[model samples]
Target: MAEIVELSEADQQRKDLILRNLQESLGVDKLTKQLSTGKNIHVYWGTATTGKPHVGYMVPMQKIADFLNAGIKVTILFADVHAFLDNLKSTFEMLEYRVEYYQRVIKALLSSLDVPIEKLSFQLGSSYQLSEAYTQDVLKLCGHISQRDALRAGAEVVKQVDSPLLSGLLYPLLQAIDEQYLKADGQFGGVDQRKIFILAEEQLPKIKLGKRWHLMNPMVPGLTGGKMSSSEIDSKIDLLDKPNVVSMKIDNSVCVRGNPEENGVLQFFRFVVFPIISPRIIDIKGQSYSNYDEIVESFEEKESISAEALKEFLKAFLIGILTKVQDKCENEELRNIMNHAYSSPPELDTSELSEGFQTVLELKDMGGDRMKEIKGDCELITSAKLYQKLNTDEPLKVLWRVSAKGKVNLGHLGGLLQLKRLQALKCECSILISDIGGFLDNGKCPWNALEARAKYYEEALKQFMKAISLENVPIRHSRENQYERDYTLEMYKMASKVTKDASAIVEGNTLATHLCPLYHALDVHFADVDLLITGEEQRPFVILGQQLCQGIGLPSQAALLFPKIPGMNGERMSSSNTEQHLDPLDTVKQINKKIGSSFCEPKNVKDNVALDLARLIIFPLHEGKEVVIKRDEKYGGNVSFSDYAALEASFAEEIIHPSDLKPFVTEQINALLEPIRTALTPQSKMITAAFPKVAKKK
Candidate 1:
């Protein structure tokens, strides 16, 4: 049993403010003192998957630390089962790997932060069972609520797409039930999860369980905009990022000019780092800072609070935490062995391209002339300033080369000026050669030149789709209109087709080979599309795509879509060769170390144009039935929309006018997500077929 400690008046004030902010933002009430009465407060937060715990995980971790500092009993729950449900990208083996990874990472994070790990008891979600008594209590309570209200509340609890998986719908209720099972006095999460706690409060009393539940939520914003997310790479910094990586990410963060109220970096500072560094003071020095301004100032000044300085601070902070965690993780070797007791046999390799393929020019004189011409054109186009500008600020330099045999070699092409554009040749009739068909046939076109290109592209597309799906919108591109349109159409078509094929396979009890092409096509579309929309919007669609694929029993290649944190040479970090990379542990150490030294600067107007476009053109399409506020002559004004596009465009123009879409967009998103509340309702006996119930206790 954990003991509770008393807090000083100042500490209580800080906790009160934090709790108040959380309640206001999330629409939940503060916890009673009973929940906080334990001397050792144990609050656990973890992802469903073991992929690197992103910034979202930090929210709960920080809360635990705060509670610990306040002399409360703290218990950290890994929620491994929940991780498996949420992180569909992971294989069972990968899931195991992630569990270890998180255990180590989290421990490291805590240790680095100088948090007291001794008082902390880390437990996996699966370790605790839903005892028959607990289920009976839940069912008895379920009987008290009307089915309509149950459905409505249950829907709100999950707050995600309606899942056919019984567990998905029941999970929230189960989470609430955990409070009773653990005899926890309180629960904590981000503001987004306030509804769940509310539902828990309503149902627990109905079941005759103690009504003494306390809920605490933190306000954490995304790095680019909106909410901080584990899935959105740019929105939140990974604790494992290298210093350079963290610095680059911060430099690219979204920050509004004149009004610093909505800057992502500042939000991070206010919600995450500030509480750790200076909990009582909302403003530093004479500057009146909110969550956003703190980060902006930190990045703007390269001195103590500069991007480099902050990165170093975070890096050191994280490294210290992880080091301590690593020490604890090593003690679980026996548990690790037990977890692997029923491992599956290794998969046999069946790749025909193991030896790889040769480049078009390498394949004798099959299409040598056309290959040379195309290669020359590629080089010229790559060197053009316009083309380079179209690609990246770093210039459209070639980062890697694929040999005829599909062997990848790293190199850099100096500038776009060195390359010629084949499109230019297409404009002149004299330059049009019939032999150009040879280029296509011999794989001389850029599309076919590299074996890994499509793979990489597909990976990027999947990531893009996942990002868009979360926000429920199509991705927008500023350039290459035709390409973007074609890619979007292809993606939707692929999704529809794959969904149909997957249904057929599931119904017929057939294997899923037929669905592979659709999956591949969808993947390819995402990759090609991502190149065009990389920095424009938070790619929610990519995350959604991964979830969809996983739901449909397809492999989610999410690992491939993670943005490459460029190496010192401006090339993506690679582990393929000895000279190019360090081992995983070393890489983790380097990232942890480097992240501390880096700093994140706020994004300027010109840099965040894409995010602006997304807020304007894309976001509204998914607004569903949310009401929009309009100023009018009669009774002020309220305009609601079923047309997402019109609403999105209107909101973009109105709210994001000259670059301020944070408030409007977030408000609309909250409305759009309201329907998900119904999905969280507790299922009744009529729908009890959805879940496999545990037998009643003897």
Candidate 2:
């Protein structure tokens, strides 16, 4: 029995335009159904703004022209980002310039064929790729796929190397996301990107998006009769090439008789020349090719339609089409774009030097003994190998956390100073004020006052950052983003995996205290936090975060532990306990009074708040310099300790009295607080708003 499929006049035209010359098509029925319903299909063709457009690109250009002729809306996407993410072939710096070049050049290409530029629209990936909804989808996509799948999906398109960049895997995911985000009914790309297209087909539905059609054009051979590549100038002819140059390139191209399969000349006429030129006819060497098939037929036959005849015919046809393209590419704007887009990439310093010297040079400000103190209060680093943010200029995102249950204190201020130092080392740190967590901590942060308290903590930190010249550091209230689309989704995943373990470790029953670990862990994924700068007390959070790295599938965060800072009573500083620490916003008289009565035992230096003030507060603030203890001539007359160790040893052996140390450290501490004190004046209202005075009961 014979079966037939019927198509309306308009539907057949649209299908032919869309499917003609396509090497592969997915969801063809889905596309036909849309056409049957009188729906105008929107097909987007994206080109990564990486390299120049060549004669090989004409294959897709001819197809794009066909889409326009069929009355389909076409969006030419300048994928400005995919190139940067594709093994950094084009970096973020070159993205803007290349995008402009791609836009101009692609338009010129379509205009060269008179592809009806009116129906064609152009858009950039950056325009919508960074939106909140889109970013949530990206996060969702990350959770679905494994590292192996991501690697394989992009293996063909992303440049392969020994140690591939994470951005390379992200390249395909971003491209897959573009299919749904652009609202395209189908995507148009080369068959080379079939894996990524297939990835989109499977992953988009998981994210609640319908599977779209994929239109793939076959790979056309270059002038060398091999793959057309942007890197090899001789392999393809540039759109802007002069007639003589194009003729010369065409003349030298490989086109063997009866070998159209690998013949570049015959492929061009078959794919591009005949598709756009008209009448489906070409006269060559007393023979004619009314269609691409006739030329292929000639190639299969011996002693007919010689390679030179085909090359000569292709040369004239390309020359005619390139006249407008060359004219369009010669604009002043294009020249400027080319100059910037193709400029040399930044090079790394490669002068030969010893490894030890290189390490020292890389350390810069945080060199030698000072590096030990930078660990703050932590006894151990969880993942020592991942600690590369230090001493290097590579930018890494640092997740700096603080519980906004109480006012800012000197203990936290000292950590901020270290955070500022890391900022100098090129770490982009952001403060996550866990307001919602604080609210759940059995009224440590009252429900009614959560937002206010959060604002206060943020403002106080901002004032401190300004004093330390780190005013640009970002500060975010957790409650503001706790319920964010991706955050909440990942929070559930984190909650499922490790909530019991988090509950097992913590003594407290408060929701925030137990859930804090889970929230902190999930922040590594949602926030893309590369490093966690926290005191040793928060070790469990980092431990759980490492476990979640597998389930969430984002990069894990390395925790840098700072040794816990001692409070006035010689214990880990508590923001909730006013007696244990001095307020950063304290008055000079308050500061002096607090230090005068603080616990500083003579002949004992371990975890002593007073010595800590000297080591953490004074020395680091003074750029790791020596401290002088001011006193009378008989009382060791202005004794000096060259380092924190010397000072600690002297205090341990009773050489420096707590009495003398108190006044000297107090004076230095006040001096250190001066900038913050001054910056706090204008921002006083933030404190007033955040921590409003409570009414006392009679």
The clash tally of candidate 1 reads 106
For 363-465, candidate 1 gives per-residue lDDT tens digits of 3352334335435422111111222233332222211111111111111111111111322322110011111111122222122222233232222322323
- In order of appearance, the predictions have TM-scores of 0.40, 0.58
Q: Which stretches of candidate 2 lie over 4 Å from their true place?
A: 1-7, 91-93, 257-259, 348-698
Candidate that would win on TM-score: 2
